[model samples]
Target: MNARTNIQFINNELGQPQFVVMPYTQYLELSKSKQIDTEAGVPSEVVNMVFDNNYSPAQAWRKYLNLSQVDVANRIGISKSAYSQYYKIQKLRKSMRIKIAEALQIKPELLDF
Candidate 1:
């Protein structure tokens, strides 16, 4: 309306206040809190086995240490192909199971069915 009215409204708006700047301490804290993982090494074989076998993370860890399918056969004192047959039939012998568990440094119960 009038200059005086406009001035009055402008003063009222100014009185409501607004942020002009963030505090320096808060900015510093935000920068410090940000994180990135730069740690380096080969990924664990246990983790890789879990993904490859479609087994649960725990099972994969156990199997990764037990050795390859071929190695498992050798360690348990069976031919690889025979072991494959036994595996297919769900016919793991008790001695073989114990040998596998010992080789893997795991309890037999940890292995998947």
Candidate 2:
């Protein structure tokens, strides 16, 4: 193939790589948004902890709140039957755990994953 043809062929095969790149202004806006979200009463530490895959802050919060499975389920917006499944200790997704921690206003890291 000609050089131009080869370049076109290679480019076609590779396609465009997907990426997420924010300009400085956009980055600042996103940062400000995150700060605002944090300030809206969800503690930063709890948010971080709940998002961290290595921790299960829900367990700790459940203990601290002295809530039974039914109570925790009600507070966290889950069904009591679903919460019962975790009674003997079950894993939670990172987002779910964080949501629970945020709902309880507790540090996510304290859950002891």
Candidate 3:
């Protein structure tokens, strides 16, 4: 095979490769061929917001998508102040995370750090 060797293998206790790691772009390409939508990925825009502005994934996506707290809160059927409190939370529960993602109109995995 004439494939690039830009991948890594993590071995388990039995000395056999149990996990693989590679560049995000490469993984996306492979996933496309396999028809999988893992969505376990972050966008560059959201990543930059997290690093440059110290914002949470939810906050970052909200800003990137040009949606206001009130807008998302309305979508989630909550008050703006209540929605704002979610950003202050260190980690939201799965159901809340999904609600936030839905409000932001993005894949839930994008909100995962």
Instruction: Please report, as a residue range, the 10-residue window in candidate 1 with the lowest summed lDDT.
Output: 35-44
Q: Per-residue CA lDDT of candidate 2, range 1-113, in tens?
A: 63432111223345764434545576567777774343334434544545654334565445545667677778778898886665435466666666566666665544444
lDDT of 1 by residue, 4-108 (tens): 321122224558644224455654565477532212221256546555655543345435555576776776677878666645323246665666656555665
Winner of 1 and 2 under lDDT:
2
Ranking by lDDT: 3, 2, 1
Q: What are the Cα lDDT values of the candidates? A: 0.51, 0.55, 0.83
- Clash count, predicted structure 1: 0
Task: Itemize residue pairs with steric clashes in candidate 2.
Answer: none
Residue 48 local lDDT, model 1 = 62
- What C-alpha lDDT does candidate 2 achieve relative to the native structure? 0.55
Q: At residue 56, what lDDT does model 3 achieve?
A: 86
lDDT of 3 by residue, 1-113 (tens): 68869899999999999878899898898877975454555657888988888888898888888988889999999999889889755467899999998988787767777
Q: What's the CA error at residue 108 for candidate 2, in Å?
A: 1.8
- For model 2, the stretches where C-alpha displacement exceeds 4 angstroms are 1-60
Which candidate ranks first by lDDT, i.e. highest? 3
